[model samples]
Target: MDERLSVAPVVPRFAAAIREVAAVTAFYAGGSIGSGDYRPGISDLDLVAVIAAPLTRARRDRLRSLHRTLGVAKLHCAYVSLPDISDVSRKHVNWAHERMFRRPLSGISRAELHQFGVTVYGPSPAELVPQIGREELATAARAELRGYWTGAVRRARVWRTDLHVDLGLTTVSRAGVTIETGRLITKREAIDRLPALGVPDDLTDEIRRRRAGEPVELTEPQIRARAVVARALMREQLTRLLG
Candidate 1:
C-alpha cells in the first residue's frame, strides 16, 4: 500500500517487455491492482497497454508475453489502440486478444486510468488516456449486467467455484458505485456498501468468504438466485444514473 505500484513477480517482466518492445507506447496498473487492494493470492494484475500503432508482429509478441509469462488466471490487462480512444467508433480489436486473453479491451478500462490508475511505465494515465464520459461508462456497465452476467451463470455454471461468484458479485457492486460516482471503489469498499446498494446478504457473505480464503460452496439454485438479485441491483443503479 505504501508503494504506488503494488504487483506480482510478473510485473518486472511486463515492464521489461514494454521497454524491450517498441510497439507499446505506455502501460498503467488499473482496477484493484492500482487501488491498493492488491492481494498476491486473490487479486489480478490489471493493466492497460496502449499500442503505438497496429498490433504489429513485435507488438503482437509483446502482448503474448503477458499471458505466457504471467499466466491467464493471474492477469487480465487490455491492449488498447489510440484510434479507438480518439474516435469513439473505431472499435478496439478484441478478436486478436481473445486468443491469449481472458477478456478484451474496454472503454471503461481506458476511462478508469484517468481516475484510479497507477502509472507503472507510461506518460501518466491522464495524458495518455482520452476522456470517456460517464454515460459511456454507465452504458458499458448496463450491458454487462443485462448481457454478460445474465448469461454467464447459465452458460458456464458460475457457482461451481467461489472465484466466479466473488468476481461476479464484486464486479456488479463496484460497477454500481462507479456508474453513480464516476469513480471506482476498492473491493473492501464495495463489500461494505453492498447492503445499502441493494446486494443480497447471502451473496455479500460469499464475497467476504471468497476474500478471506474461506472454503465456500453454493448450489445451482443459490447462484442463480444471487445472480438474479445482483443483475437487478446493477440495472436499477445504472438506469438511475444513466437516464
Candidate 2:
C-alpha cells in the first residue's frame, strides 16, 4: 500500500472490529476512507466486509459494541455483503468500486472484486440490501430528507434543539428537487425551489423559521402525512426523469 493510501487512521481499528463480528469469513475494501463516493457530511468511516454465515448471538452483540465504540465523532462504520453491490444498482457503485484502488489502504483491490463480478463471503448474503437506481435513488433519498424535516419541525416546537437542527438539514436535502451537477440542490438554495416541486407552504415556512433560530416541532402524525406526499412526489419525478 502507498504511504498516502494509509491516510485513514481508523482502518486498522475498523478491521479489528470486523474480526469481532464472528462470522465474517473474509474482509476487504478498507482503503476508501475519505472517498466522496458515499453521502456528503458523512465524516464517518465506511467499510465493506465479507462474512461467513450463521451469525451467532455473540457476533451480533459484538457488532453492537463496535457501534457504540465507533459512534464517537469522526468515526462511523457501515457493513455490507458483496452481493449487496448488485442491489445498489446505481452506476455510481461501479464508479465507486473502481475508485477503491486509489485509496490509501485497501484489503481488497478494485480489479479483483469486479473481475470476480459477484463474490460471496459468508454462507449467504445479508438479509437486507440497498436497492436503488441512479435516477430513482436520488428521488427516494430526497423523500427521506422531507420526512426528517417534518420531524425537525416538531422537535423545534418541543425545544429539542439537537434533533431539530439535525433533521432540518436532512429534510431540506430530501424534499429539494433541483439537481445541480448531479447533486440535490444546496440546502440554502433548496428553499427557493421547494415551491416548484409542490412542497407545502407550511413546511417551507417551518424550515425557514428553524433556520432563523425559531423553535419548531413536527409531531409523528404530521411527519407521516408529509412523508406520504413526499414519497409520491419523489416517485413521480424519478419515474419521469429515469424514463
Candidate 3:
C-alpha cells in the first residue's frame, strides 16, 4: 500500500473483512481511490471484489453483517462472481451506504477498472475484466444525462439538498467532458470547470469548500434559489449534449 494514497489504510482493512465472509479472488479499488484524487471524508471508497463463486444466501447474510460492523459510510463494493465479470450489465450483489442491494455493474465502472484500477490483493483488473473503450464510455455518459439526470431536473425538491446540488452539477461537468473527449476527470477538476458550464462562482466555491470538509450553511430560500439555477443549467447542458 502506498502511503500517499489517502485511502491506503482502508484497502487492507476492507479486503480482510470481506474475505472473512466471501471467497473474494481479485480485489480492486477504483473511482477516486484509483484516480489519485481521493478526499478522506468526502470521497467514496469504490471497490470491486471478484468472488470465486456466486454468493450463497448464508454468505450474503454474513457479508451484510460484516458491513454493518465495519460501519464505514461511503465504503461501497460490488461483489461480482468470476463468471459474471465480463458482463457489464449483469446485476450483482452490492453493498453501499451500509445497505445491501443489487445493481448492474455499470459501464463507467468497468471503464474505470480497465483504465486506472488498483490491484490491492489479486491479479490485475485487465486479467479479470475486459477493457472498456472510449466510445463505450462516451455512450454511457450520454445515457446517464438522458436517463437519471433528465428525471432529476424534473424533481425540484432534490436539488435543494447539498449532496444533490454538488454531485449533480459535478456529474454534468464530468459527463460533458467524457462525451466530448472520452476521458474521465476527477471531482476536483470538475469543480474547477463548473464556471465554464455556467455555474455561479460562489456556488462552485461553496461546493469546493464543502468537499474540503469545511462547514457550510445555507438558509431555506438560499438553497432553493441555488437549486433552481442548478436545475436549469443541467437542463441546458443536457440539451446541448443530447440534442
Candidate 4:
C-alpha cells in the first residue's frame, strides 16, 4: 500500500466497534480511501466487512445502534457473510446515510476491493473476493445507469440541488468510461472529465472547487439553468452508452 493510502481515523475505530457487535472475519476499505483520492470532510468512506455468518435480527439491531453511536457521517459499509462473497446477487446487510438495509454487493465495489482495497484487518481483498472481468464490469456499469440514473433523470426537482448536479454528472462520466474501457476512475478524475462531456464549464468549475472544500453558491435561477443542462447531458450520455 502506498504511504498516501492511509485509512481515516474513524476506520479503525469503526472496525473496533464492529468487533464489539459481531465477529468480523475480514475487514477492508475501498472507494476514495482505497484509491488515494480521499478528501477529508468531502469524500465518503466505503467499506466492506466479511463476517463469520449472516447477520441475525439481534445482530442487526446491535449494528444499527453501533452506527448511530459512532455518528460518523458519510461512512457506508456492506456486511457480507463469508459464504456470500462469491455471489454478487445476494443481498447483505448494509448501512448508508444512517440507514440500515439489505442490498447486494455491487460489481464496481467488488472490483475496487480487488484493485486497491486497504486491509484494516484480515486478508487482502483479492485473497477473499473473486476477480471481476472487464465485461462483467462493463455490464454492471450499464445496469447502474439504466436502473438508477434512468429514474433519477426523470425527477427534475432533484437536479436543482448541488448534490444531484455534482453526483449526477460525475456518475455519467464515470459510468461512460467504465462502459467503454472497463476501468473505474476516481471521482476526482470524473470531475475533471465533466467539461469534455458537454457539462457547462462554470458548473464544472463549481463542482471542482466545492469538492476541494471551497464554498460555492449558485443563485436559484442559476441552479435551475444548470439543472436543465445537467439533466440533458446525463440523458444524452445514458442513451449513447446504453444503446
Q: Local error of candidate 4 at 176, Å? A: 1.1
Model 3 ranges with Cα > 4 A deviation: 4-8
- The stretch of ten residues in a row with the least summed lDDT in candidate 1 is 93-102
lDDT of 4 by residue, 64-130 (tens): 9889988999999999899888998999999999899999998999998887688888888878898
In angstroms, how far off is 20's CA in candidate 4? 4.5
Q: Write the per-residue lDDT of candidate 2 for residues 177-205, one digit (tens) a residue.
A: 42223343334455556566666778667
- Order by lDDT, highest first: 4, 3, 1, 2
- Where model 1 places Cα greater than 4 Å from the true spot, the runs are 58-66, 69-72, 88-98, 101-104, 153-161, 197-203, 217-243
lDDT tens per residue, model 1, 98-153: 35433445666666677778776758877867777878877766666665666664
Q: Quick one: best TM-score, which candidate?
A: 4
- lDDT-wise, the better of 2 and 4 is 4
- The collision pairs in model 1 are none
Task: List the candidates' TM-scores in order.
Answer: 0.75, 0.41, 0.94, 0.95
Score each candidate by Cα lDDT: 0.65, 0.42, 0.87, 0.87
Candidate 4 segments whose C-alpha is farther than 4 A from its true place: 1-7
lDDT of 2 at 220: 76
Per-model RMSD to reference: 4.1, 11.7, 1.5, 1.5
Pairing residues by index, what is the TM-score of model 4?
Answer: 0.95
Give the Å error, residue 166, model 4.
0.4
Steric clash pairs (candidate 4): none
Q: Model 4, residue 128: what's the lDDT?
A: 88
Local accuracy of candidate 3 as per-residue lDDT tens digits, 88-197: 78899999977999987788888888876888788998888987788888888888777688888899989888888899899899988988998888889999999999
- Give the least accurate 10-residue stretch of model 3, judged by summed lDDT: 1-10
